[model samples]
Target: MQSANLQKQKLELIEKIIHTDDQNTLDFLKSILNDETSDYELTDEQKQIVEEATAKYYSGEEPSFTWDEVKNNIRKRNFQD
Candidate 1:
């Protein structure tokens, strides 16, 4: 099932690449396939924070909210009449 989905995705990407004429976009996609080096890096402290947060979320120790819940809370706070 996953393989079928992946093949579909690959075909869609191939179609897009064939139809795309923008040199910059082609260059960016080429770099994605060719580049091995990643430029983004996090500091030790930042990495620790992220790891802790992920652990808490997975362990059900942290509260999580949906996008709608977040927007409603923001509106309640800002739009009181």
Candidate 2:
């Protein structure tokens, strides 16, 4: 309900932006759109770490925790120091 209204408002704002003749505003909007659509590139070391984690997960070498346990652990850590 609230989400639908927000979506409608976004569409209305976008329509207004589309009809604008301001070059600076249009260029700023284009840059923002490009940034949003761009893919995130990870460094080699970061990629290696992600690959290692993926391998561990697929090899059943990674420890898995339930959502409730994870939340409880987070709460404990947050409350403690």
Among the numbered candidates, top TM-score falls to 1
Candidate 1, 23: how far from true, in Å? 20
Over 4 Å off, model 2:
1-35
Worst 10 residues of 1 by lDDT: 31-40
Question: Model 1: residues >4 Å from true position, as ranges?
Answer: 1-38
Per-residue lDDT of candidate 2, residues 25-65 (tens digit): 88778889787663569999999999999999889999878
Write down the TM-score for model 1: 0.49
Q: Residue by residue across 47-74, what tens digits does model 1's lDDT show?
A: 9999999999999999999999999999
